[model samples]
Target chain A: MKHIKGIFAVIAIVMLSAFTTVSSGYKIGDIATDFKLKSSDGTSVSLSDYKDAKGFIVIFTCNTCPYSVAYEDRIVALDKKYKGKGYPVIAIMPNNPDVQPQDNMEAMIQRAKSKGFTFPYLMDEGQKISPQYGATKTPEVYVLQKTSKGNQVKYIGAIDDNYQDASAVKSKYVENAVDALLSGQQIKEPQTRAIGCSIKL
Target chain B: MELYFYTMRIVCLLLLILTASCKNESRQNEKAVDLDYNEDFSTVPLEIYDFEGLKPFLKTNTDKTYVVNFWATWCAPCIKELPYFEQLNAAYSDKNVEVILVSLDFPKKYDSHLKPFIKKNNLKSKVVALDDNDSNTWIPAINPDWSGAIPATLIFNKEKRQFYEKTFTYEELETEIKQFLN
Candidate 1:
């Protein structure tokens, strides 16, 4: 009976590890593959479209989430400040249209227009991109830099330390990563986490 | 005759002061009763905390099972699963189980959003507000499996601790609780 229990324990451990590996998304330094997703402006947007760009600020955001709404201005500010420095923002709406009607293509277009977004608000149809990046929440960020290997994910997580008050934010995680890349310096903090609404199925 | 009249005057003043104090006490008691009946029962004062202050809630070090739920007013899924947790809290009081709802609402929205929400839902479980700015530090500390998603839960006792980054129905929650029910 003891030998049988040991065998069962090994099986359980192996299955748990396998499950974790299947669920985890991209890690830092992983090469992110490009996607040609549809944007709110009736245009196809892809990472490779920006030829002169050094990196991309790929953020997974949606319209309905209050957390996402709070960060819209900050995300816009990131694009405005960093776009001129070769890191343009590429925001994706990854929630299922069925679960979140507010995040549909029509709402995405209206939100982008009203907010004067200086970036493309693309819809991740079929919700494919977020899972690849292992993004589980709205307002999650991934900063990728173009390299000889491909677009290398330099940073993954929140925009800053404080989600509620941007001014009160101490560590600008995404900004610091992009700035380091521009100055040819190694990024200090490569990953961060923030509370956000789960991507609706 | 002069001494007698002075004593009478002093007695009158004392009576007046005593009646005035009596009226004030009754009035204050009336207001307290009114507040209890008033439909405005949302006066549940929240226990606000930063990351350091919030850490103790997780490590209660008691024999009773602790069901700590991380939720926000804005999270739809979290809101949906709340009633189950509330039911478990109410039904399992004698079973040595406790449920705590940790609100992750923004500090700015505490007055306008979180408080009103607690009142409207009539949440029976003890609700506390976690307004910590450093989420990156605390999110992983809660559980490495947590992807900073709402509707997450932590169940623990003296022997074992388990965290879930997903929603649960009453049956599902009770099943997990039963494991610690020795």
Candidate 2:
């Protein structure tokens, strides 16, 4: 009887904690759940598939958002710079095609082709994955660092300080975090904010 | 020495007169624009703002209530619910209520997209472009619970404050306004 009661208590605590994590969104240092979303190339990809990667730059971006458009080239550049360094960029379009026709898979393919994107631009089908990560807008970022337990969210928020003109940017938050992680140092600033188009549901 | 001082003073006086005339000309130009806006509200240019620039709109010292909404031209839900805000603005104007539409339109598209959309829709609410790129800072500053989503609204008066991150129908928006009014 005592053993059964202890097991029930443990189950209840685990369930409660799982519910809380889902509702609160992915915070810094939290273990992020791996998702197998369809890439723009018509093939499904998962974070766990990247065996040699030290970390992943999971970006919630889309085709129609002007803010996303602004960062498209920069995102490509980030992938070029960091993919070989073991932190490849994974772009996800989180908006529902029914609500945002412009963000449809066809558009994603066209954008990827035109931009010469080396990174995988995945579609978050049914809008299932973004809410779990708590992505509010297009171009939001979550830097996940690999650990023995799992991939932990190391940083969250915008790519850089300036979204208008990249050359004039004084602070590159994403680069700073990835570089710190590469050097096996703690991220100095793990979070930032940038104006972006809201994810259409 | 006397002649030199007298010449300098006259030059100074002429410079002052020239400066005042320029100032008056600019003021007249501004007044003319204001008059034009009052006569035809459609041509009013949307003002650009950053997070700090948008602070005054967040909090008010007056008895009047403000319904400030963050939106973009491309956001489907924002477009769908904008009519409710327009109706609320018209219905509650006499009650000292105001609506401020904050556009997060990409800066590059302000002329190509945002301006044309406003003209086409005939948006009556005071629309302003929020050009701040660092949203992680301001989104939470606007409301701690805000996930930086659009179609988000902040309704407030002198005493109470309410923030909503969901799309609202006409009835739902009206009810929220009424709650603040009462």
Candidate 3:
């Protein structure tokens, strides 16, 4: 009876520890897992494909998310501004069609064309890729830097400090990270809380 | 003396049993109260169709720090990080931290799924439905680079607004909120 009670106590402790560990999610310094997703143009784009680039921006966004839509121009601008600088932005639509049909491929194609997106707006079908990047929301920015070890995530957070009044913006997080990487400097703010629509699992 | 000892043991056992039963009863009562609260709030569907209507609901009080969280009923990461927002709201109750939960659940499932989920979680933040249909106009308004995703959260303090598109642990969330609050 004592042995049984001891086993039960041990099991409870193990379960509690397991729960605590599972609750604490991703962090900076984690290597970004590669994924192959189809772009709006139906071409497959993978993170590994951009291996030659100095850094990569993996943004989990979708067609229907207003927040994602809001960042459309900025994302395009980021792609245009940084792609040449070797920090190309890769946009991924992580919404599930079963829940949000409007976010499907047809809408994605239209949205990309309307926005004149220079970056690859990849469709994360089966919703498999977003979680791998620990992407929780649309417009979530993951800045990756290639080191000797591999593609290490440098900064993960918001684009800029202001969405409403851009003129009074204090911090340009995305730009700063890119600039730091370009100048061969370390990112000061390594991680940030991403704000946007929760990715439909 | 043996008889007295037996009586003492019996009395102790009865006290233990009585206390155990009382604790169980209190737990059951607490669960019942929670169920009643859930029932009261569960029926109200997270309104997800009125984008224009929601604009007015969005507190334009730029003086306060607005923490808007975009979550859906289905996202696991959203579920994981929601408690931190609740805690943040509670901690910063004295401050201008207004924690808003924007449900991104589909319009059709708002009533059946979203409301119950929110209620079950006992979310303490202000809940709203962002009913914007067209992503083009709305997304740019929110942020230019956003590729619509869920579990997104925005922290706005009139002069400064921060957009995050990633899941956060409590420490990270607190750090961001503290930055805004400070």
Candidate 4:
């Protein structure tokens, strides 16, 4: 009876852990945690860096993914449009250089410089931050609204409906979410999805 | 004569899948931008689809177990695991296990890049492209858990269905698919 009970307990524990591990990342209205990561410009950046900010456009993107590259210009435009409106774009490279050397910090610096990015392109060293937000792909967006509670994950997903061509885009999920925050209105689309390269660990 | 008929039937089924992928004009035009693709793939009959067109493949009401793997030419990890899916298809096709390689390569690369990669690899499994731009809609429709990342997979039969958002080894895939087998 003791041996049977011991076996059952171990099985239950294993099954419980297996179930918990899959249900990670943030959901809508969830209070997001903050992190201080190194930026391409050699300065440390965090969500709290912007004191007068209303919210943030947190994008988990990398230099290597074509999808990320395709959205690079649009991302820059987003920063230009919203930074003055109290919402700034904070780009994070979540891929490990070991897996994809193109995503190394030096390349990140080069990419940001060449693109004339007006945002902080930070590297998520040790990959501690992406998992917390549950970002699975490059160019994944999390629009976080700063509140009395903490930074709230307001909207999550793609930059727009048309990733192939910026001109053809109909819906810009990140922009819409941030705009909603600025207007003191509820975000219509709290979450969305877009095809992106799997984050290289 | 029986063996010949069986082979013919298999060939016809393959043909049907190819033809079913013919363009859905209305939906295609809405998402079509100014980008152009090379029509150099005269030999490669790879069917390109929006998520709406690709939906039927995911919900096949068949007796055979189906393994649909989402991959792309640019994704290194997806390419690394392509052979495993091919191997699974070869090893289990006779056992009523079918593998479908769903390529999520960009629409611009469908003809220029994906076709060459398929030919170079000499892929045996049925290959198709999901060219859907409205990913936010279809991504969750395929699986609410899927974060719209490539190399995700779906294995199903009439009795059970499973979706994986992780890389798979051949043995690991075999082990998972075996549970649905007799």
Please give the lDDT score at residue A18 for candidate 3.
Answer: 48
RMSD of each: 21.9, 18.4, 18.1, 13.1
TM-score of chain B of 1: 0.75
**What fraction of the native alpha-carbon contacts across the interface, defined at 8 angstroms, is recovered by model 3?**
0.14
Q: What is the lDDT of residue A16 in candidate 3?
A: 54
- Runs with alpha carbons beyond 4 Å of true place in candidate 1: A1-21, B1-42
Q: Compose the digit string of candidate 2's lDDT tens values, residues A14-93.
A: 55544444354677888999999999898899999999999999999998776788899999999999999999999999
Docking class of 2: incorrect
**Native-to-model Cα distance after best TM-score fit, residue A57 in candidate 3, in Å:** 0.8
Candidate closer to the true structure by DockQ (higher is better), 1 or 2: 1
TM-score of 1: 0.84
- List DockQ, one per candidate, in order: 0.19, 0.14, 0.08, 0.22
Off by over 4 Å in 4: A1-23, B1-42
lDDT of 1 by residue, A87-168 (tens): 9999999888877777899999999999999999999999888877878888999999999999999999999988778888
Candidates' C-alpha lDDT: 0.82, 0.80, 0.69, 0.82
Overall local distance difference test of candidate 2: 0.80
Tens digits of lDDT, candidate 4, B119-148: 767999999988878888888888766778
Of the candidates numbered 3 and 4, which has the greater TM-score value?
A: 4
2 or 4: which has the higher lDDT?
Answer: 4
Candidate 3 chain A weakest ten by summed lDDT: A17-26
